[model samples]
Target chain A: MSAVVSLSNVHKSFGAVQVLRGVSFEVGPGEVVAVIGASGSGKSTALRCINALETVDSGEITVCGHKVHDPALDRRALRRDVGIVFQSYNLFPHLTVAQNIMLAPTCVKDMGKAEARKLAESVLARVGLSEKADNYPEQLSGGQQQRVAIARSLAMQPKLMLFDEVTSALDPQLTGEVLRVMEDLARGGMSMILVTHEMAFARKVASKVIFMHQGKVWETGPGAMLDDPQTQELREFLHNGL
Target chain B: MSYQFDFSALLPYWPVFLQGVWLTLKLSALATVFGFVVGTLCAIARADGPPWLKTVVAIYVETIRNTPLLVQIFLVYFGFASLGLKVTANTAAVAALVVNVGAYTCEIVRAGLESIHKSQLEAAECLGLTRTQTYWHVIVRPAIERVYPALTSQYVLLMLASSITSQISAEELTAVANRIQSDTFRSFETYIVTGALYIVLSFVVRAAFTLFGLVIFPRRRKLGTAI
Candidate 1:
């Protein structure tokens, strides 16, 4: 199959500040591509563009065969084929974990209540939170809430999953728990792309690593590229931990 | 010390006072229900309707909110009379109260609706919820839940303001009190009784609203306090 996602010479701006400038990359099926960069390096904006959350200025972005930059695109159809988990968890606080997981399935896919609950239960088990189905988002710990958010997206059965700094808000210990769930998903052969700052985690799990700096893709290679970065910027970024 | 108090003179008018209380309660109830409906609909339109529709709702809200409720009541009651409509005082009273309260309710509810964070709407969209689905589930219900107390207070104020309808001889509590005072010639005692009844009615409306909040938002108790 063609690349699951492709962006070529993409350009985006917020007023005078251009966030993404001439960015280009592609993700193959079942491949875990980790994008590592400093804050405000346009990594998050690129992920949002994939989900059609941000309209592009000029470029080509195709995700799951939907033209991301097209004005006539059916966003709901595109969203159905791709799922995204945000840094803040963003679970509906008013809803129980099971209801949050079942929301998309029942409302969008027209799944029956019993079937949706069964689906919710099964996904919750995958994330190791089956017992917390009835708990509200605010009642759970930060890591647990992030895991439930992943399960909410998983219930949609999207072909591609995007994670935008999902561990940014958690402490080191909590980050480990969320990472474990993600590693398991990667092992299960789910096509994924994640924007993350954890260099060790990216090297361990990402099949391909993309380094972005100053709104440009600075380097691209397999996970081993971190050990032998050809670009001086990547080496300096790794050394400074920025 | 110039005049003597005579509570005894108003004793036989208790039945008339009860009738006034009953009519006032009925009028208050009808206005509350319809006013809430009208206000919420207007709020939704102002928040998310098309530009022209939003403009229309804005004009209605500002027009009513800027004018005195008494003048609006007169416009509904006497204005309809001049038009050869001849609407009963009761009908005009409810209509006037509804139109007046609806504007205030619209402003209150619109504030609630705007308080919802933009990120919540983004999450709902990512979940593939249609526009209508997002509005009801993610925006309206949660917004209203967040602002339930504000709405309860607004409706209670509307109930008190219903007393103004008595000017048009709607036969509500104050109007009934007027007839009793005239018959018994005891204005002080009659007004004293009416004021106490108004206080009781306020408490009753508040308690009723608290119970209603409990019903529509059963999950609120589980997640947090009554708010």
Candidate 2:
């Protein structure tokens, strides 16, 4: 099976600190890959590089056929195929939930207003937020807002989604709400790469699990590999995270 | 000295005072609209334009902000004369006021643009919004909305400062008041009346701003809270 996303020996640094040191990974079509790591492990940086949010210092990243590492890469084209949701749930405060989802379709794709509104409605319904379409981001709870964020990304019909610590800011119950929505997407066979601290969610929903440490992919295997970690680093990480 | 105050002495010049008020309003309206447009463009340039453009906007903002409005008006009015141009005082006045207020509006708006979090911009980028679309929809529109109150305050001060153009002999409120005071010799009563009219004008302007805000920013109106 062909991979939808691939990275080979990607290197990135911030000033003097090297964040991603020769990291590599791949996500096949319909693969749900969970990247579990401690803080400062460069997992977020790798995910950001996939979306071209941060350029790789040295190496190759290809996402949905776009050569992300190329200097003349069409960034907007790359973005059209990839959707990203941040931990902050960065919804435009001035727009309603429906408008937030409709923005890109109308502006980038030039969809008609009625069509965009219908698309927004369907996506909001997917996240079970149909009633809150007219509500502003501030009016919703943290969980509802994150679901709306998911729906906003879904409006673009992106082939791949990137979730960067999306549940980190939420309480256990709110996190459960967001995780449930993500699990639904995974069950529906959407390709996703998520950086998470939730060991249990990663274990249940992820087809493959990767453990990143010291700016590299330290260990990778099926979800069951987490229970039988070969590296002492993964063992200690699972121990402390529990 | 017990001086008798007669406000009624200035009542005969009501028609003149009304015309002055109307002219002042027109000057302020034109300046406010053009100044805001210029300020918004300048704000966007300073924030993301090329280095040369940013430097040009910076110098303009600094130059106008540091100089006196009176002197700026004089320079604009007489500067055209020196160039052997036949510009009227009112034209010079509007040009000077727009230039002056545009600089201040640029600074106020740039602050609003900066206050937006980087994450918001990242989201816009992820959605594949072009630079113009991103700036208009996510950056400038919201930034201007955020700083609307400050912009309103600046515009009110601009209207008051329009009185300074009277020195150039523009036929605005203060100029009309100048003629009234000299002709009636009730300079004391004339100024008192004009000052009261100025107070009324500022209030009306503020009220209009509030109504305009209600129309444009549905989010603020719907939320029933300050943006």
Candidate 3:
């Protein structure tokens, strides 16, 4: 199977501080890649670069067959193929759940209201939020809000999804509900690159694991490699219980 | 000697006073709508447009905000005449009021725009929304909602300030009162009646804004809370 996302020797810097240096990774079709690392380890930056949220200073990054590093690239088309969810959920507080999910398809795809509403219903059902369609984001719990965020992204029918510490802000129980939704997405064969601290979920759901340390890919292999220490950094990171 | 109060003297001109009140409401409504549009566009330009546009909007906002509204009304009324452009007193009044209120509205809206989280823009961008689309759909309404109360208060002040337009003889409420007092030789009673009318007009304006806000921002209605 060919790769859906490919990043080779990607480098990025914000001001004088370099966030990503010579990072390389690939996510194949239907693959779930979990990137585990300490703060400032560049895992999240790498995910952002694939979505072209952060421009790479050097090297190539491609997503869904488009060269994201190319300045002439059709950025809107690339973005349509890539969906990203942040820890804050970022749902439009003024809109109801269905409106939030329907906004992109209607605006970007020019889908009609009836069609968008139908798509919204299916996506909300996928995220287990059918009953909250008319509710605002503030009315829902953190976990339900996150699920609504997930449904909003899923409504776009993206080729690949990026999750940036989506559960970091939630309690353990809330985190489990979000994780379950993500697990269902994985089971449905959606390609995903998740930057996470949930080691056990990564071990269980991630087909390939990339452990980053200090702005580079330090260790990488199957999920089981997390068990055997190919590098001391991965072992210490796992032992430290993040 | 005890002074006798005579509100009876002003009773004959009640129809004239009502006419003035009606004109004031109409003028205030026009100024409020156009001022809000101009101000919202200026806010967007200042917050996200090119550097040149930002500088231009900044100059407009600061110049209007720092100068007195009375001077602005004079400029709009007399400056046009000086330039050999003849405009009616009412047209000049409406133009002056819109411009004056627009500058204040721009600053209030700019604060609202700035308070939007960066992640909101990022999420909209990832959804393939163009900058304009993202702003209209995701950023503008919520920002406006967040600052609706501030906007409403600015407009209330704008309604009160319309009385200043009477100096140019716009035939609005205060101008009508000035005429009535002069004609009837009841300056004290006429002024008192005008003051009461102004108070009533403000309450009507406030109620209209409350109803309008509820319609435009239905989430506030549904949730009974600020978003």
Candidate 4:
């Protein structure tokens, strides 16, 4: 099967600082890829560049066969196919959970309100948040809000999902709940790229693990790489935590 | 030779004063509605439009805010007459009030729009919402909510400033008070009563806006807290 996402020689810089330098990776269909790195190691920027949220100064990013770096690519169309879950659950505070889920389908796809509502309800139920449909983001716990954010993306039926340290903002208990939902998504054949510090979850769910250090990929291999990293930086990173 | 306070002298003209108050409410209500519409549109342009549009809005806001409202009223009332527009004083007063308050509202609303988190816009994009949907759902609605208190305060100030229209003999509470004081020779007492009426009117406007906010942001009420 072909890769769902491909990043070739991706380079990005913000003013004088370079974030991602000559970074490259591929994620196959229905595969979960985990990116482990220290803060400011360019992992999150790499993920953001895949969706064109951050423009790459140079290089190619292809998601679901669409070239994201090309200015001619229909950005809204590209974004619809690749959903992103932020560290902070950024649900529309003014809208109910159901409304938040229904917004994209109805607005961008021109789906009818009733149809959108039905799809939203089913997706919310899939995330086990059916009862909180009418609740606002602030009314829910952090875990529930993150699940709702995941469901909001799922409502779009995206081809690929990018989790940018989604649980980093949550408490330990809330993080566990969110991770469980992510595991459920992975089991259901949803392709995902997760930038996370949860070594155990990365090991269990990731089909491939990548270690990024100093704006480049330092190591790439199966889940076992987390245990026996080849690079000194990766080994030191794993040892320091242990 | 002792001066006695006589409120009874004003009793006969109570009906006329009430009519003036009624007109004042009508004028302020119209100006506030029109001003809010203009202000909201200007704010959207300022926040999201191209640099040229933003610059134009900036100039309009600064010009209105820096100048005295009294001069603006005269500019609209007398300046328009000089230009041969021939509009009535009351119409000119309302027009001036709308233009003046619209600028201040634009600034307040723009700040609220700027306060929206960039993450919210990204979330809207990931949801595949159209540009218009993103604006209405993510930007405009919440921006308005965050600035509702400021908007109401400005509207109340606008109502109080309706007194300035009396300079051109446009019939309002202050104008009535001016005529009553001159006729009854009780300048101090007449202004005191009119000032009290204005205080009461400001309270009424604030209560109305509070109710309106409750209706518009039902989620805030249901959630039992603000985000």
Model 2: which residue pairs collide? none
Judged by DockQ, which candidate is best? 3
Q: What is the lDDT of residue B129 in candidate 1?
A: 97
Best by lDDT: 2
- lDDT per residue, candidate 3, A152-207, as tens digits? 99999999999999999999999999999999999999999999999889989999
Looking at model 3 chain A, which ten-residue stretch has the lowest summed lDDT?
Answer: A233-242
Query: Model 2, B85-180: lDDT tens per residue?
Result: 999999999999999999999999999999888898999999999988888888877888899999999999999999999999987999999999
lDDT of 1 by residue, B16-94 (tens): 8889888988999999899989999999999988999999999999899889999999999988999999789999999
Write down the lDDT of every candidate, Cα atoms only.
0.92, 0.94, 0.93, 0.90
Regions more than 4 Å wrong, model 3: none
| Candidate 4, lDDT over the whole model | 0.90
Identify the runs in model 4 with alpha carbons over 4 angstroms from their true place: B183-189, B223-227
How far is A41's C-alpha from truth in model 2 (Å)?
1.1
**TM-score for each candidate, following the candidate numbering:** 0.95, 0.98, 0.98, 0.95
| Candidate 3 Cα RMSD after full superposition onto the native fold (Å) | 1.2
Model 1 complex DockQ against the native: 0.77
Q: What class would a CAPRI assessor give candidate 1's docking? A: medium
For model 2 the local lDDT of residue A133 reads 90
DockQ of each: 0.77, 0.90, 0.91, 0.77
Candidate 4 C-alpha lDDT tens digits along A90-126 = 9888889999888888888889999999999999888
Query: In candidate 4, what are the lDDT values of residues B1-227, reduced to their tens digit?
Result: 87788888888888877887888998899899999999999999998889999999999999999999999998889888999998988999899999999999998999999999999998887777778888888999999999888998999999999999999988789998999999999887788788888988988989988888888988767755532
The lDDT of model 2 is: 0.94
Better of 1 and 3 by DockQ: 3
